[model samples]
Target: MKILVTGGAGFIGSAVVRHIIKNTQDEVVNVDKLTYAGNLESLVEVSDNVRYAFEHADICDKEAMERIFAEHKPDAVMHLAAESHVDRSITGPAAFIETNIVGTYVLLEAARAYWSGLNEAEKSSFRFHHISTDEVYGDLPHPDEHPASAELPLFTEKTAYAPSSPYSASKASSDHLVRAWLRTYGFPTIVTNCSNNYGPFHFPEKLIPLVILNALDGKALPIYGKGDQIRDWLYVEDHARALYTVMTKGKPGETYNIG
Candidate 1:
């Protein structure tokens, strides 16, 4: 299969690209706008593979996306392009709105048009998987707010959308757009909301990477609030495998919660 992966130069996306290129026979077309968080060095291992190709383009460009769909004829799409940092979103929300909401709309429309033109067999086999963060479910009961004996809530597939930050809100909006495309247009779309991911090639701004790099430099680690917030952390490689499984085997219109 030929899969087109947006944000493939980002940390988690790079892991997904590597997993697919190394473990499967599928071909990959990596589409990334080369944002600050997206580093091509992360994909150096699989960049030389014949099945791997790269496109330096933003998801918001409808003409570029249409051209890509026509040229690559991808069998599946893994949408991961977005402005994901909470601090950045809080300080400047326009980028998040532009990328997460409008960008998703552009990509969805392009995919819909391409799928509409495909033959029945090809159409039925195609999948559009939207990757999202678990932050859309909002904050779970933190350990600081609950008793030790009390049962803590985990984000399930049925969790309600209660985004607290601009980043999460934009992602929630994109998630809704994906499902709307499935319900209103009969698009074969799947959504996966994953927990915090930490592993190699992670950008330095993220908590784990920041802490490690800062500690290495003999600097104090910065912890937000009281530092008691609990989070589920998934390794990037594991998250990549889970995403591949959902994209290939998951049912359309289904939302999977991965941690």
Candidate 2:
């Protein structure tokens, strides 16, 4: 299968690209706009693979998305592109709104147009998987603040959307768009919401990486008040594997929570 992965140079996206290139016989076309969050250096290991390709493009560009879809003729598309930093979004939400909300809209339309012209077999097999965050469900009371065994306050698939930050709100909008396309146009779209991820290539804006780097550099670890936030996290490689499973074996129009 030939998969087109948007934001394929970013942390989690790079892991997905490397996983497919190193482990599977399937091909990957990486589309990224080379934002500060994205680093092509992370993909160096798989850059030379026969089944890997790269396209420097933004998801917000309709023409570029359409052209990419036409050129790659991919069997699937995994959308991981977005302005994902909460602090950045709070300081400047325009980028988040543009890339996460408007960008998703453009990509969906472009993908719909491409899918409309596919042969029966290709259309039936095609999938558009939107990668999202658990943050859209919003925050729960910090588990550390609660009693050790007081049910652990978790957000399940049935949780209501209450995005507290611009970042989460934009992602929530994109998730809604994907589902709307699935219902209104019968687009073969799937969605996945995942917990925070950490592993190799994680940029330092994230707490874990920031603390690790600061500690290694002999600086004090920066911890927020009381240092008691209990955030769920998963390894990047594990997340990559789960994404591939959902893309390959998941049913269309279904949503999965991965961690």
Candidate 3:
């Protein structure tokens, strides 16, 4: 199958692209806006591959999205384009709202329109998978806040959303839109909310990479929110594998928690 992956130049998105190109026979159409966080260098390994195609475009641009869908004729879409930094969102949220929420809406409509024109067999098999973050579940109780004997509060797939940051809130909104499209329009959509990811090719803006780069420069490692907040971390390649599994085998109108 040909999969059109938005944000395919970003960290995790690039990892997904590499995984698909190197591990599978499927073709990939990489659609990225080349935002501040997007670096084409991450995808250099797969750029020369015959099955890999790259499209430079913003997800929020309706005409660009429609053109990409028409040109690529992808069988599936893995939507991952967004402004993801919480600190950046706190300082400037307009980009987050535009890319995360509005971009998702635009992509959804574009993909839906393309899918609607497909034959019955094609429509039945097409998939639109939206990738989201676990942060939408909001803050969990700190380890110190709970006694050792008490079970630590963990977020499940069914956890209620209570987004704390502008970034998370925007993601939460996009998640809602995916579900609504599935319910209201019978779009073949699936959502996966995953934890923080860290691995090779990660941009320096992320905590682990920032710390690593700063430590190399003899600078003190930075910490946020009392340095006591707990979070889950997943390897980027592992996350890519899980995403491919979901895109190929996952059912529509279903949500999964991935880590």
Give a tens-digit lDDT track for model 2, residues 40-128.
99999999998999999999999999999998898999999999899999999999999999999999999999999999999989999
Error of 2 at 17 (Å): 0.4
Return the TM-score for candidate 3, rounded to 2 decimals. 0.98
Once fitted onto the true fold, the runs of candidate 1 whose alpha carbons sit more than 4 angstroms away are: 147-150
Q: What TM-score would candidate 2 get against the native?
A: 0.97
Q: Where is the poorest 10-residue window by lDDT in model 1?
A: 141-150
Question: How big is the positional error of residue 251 in model 2, measured in Å on the Cα after superposition?
Answer: 0.9
Clashes counted in candidate 3 amount to: 0
The 10 consecutive residues of candidate 3 with the worst lDDT sum are 223-232
Candidate 2 clashes: the total is 0
Score residue 229 of candidate 2 by CA lDDT: 70
Task: For residues 1-259, write the lDDT of model 1, one tens digit per residue.
Answer: 9999999999889999999999999999999999898999999999999999999999999999999999999999999888989999999999999999999999999999999999999999999999999999998876667788878768898988999999999999999999999999999999999999999998889999899999999999999998877789999999999999999999999999998
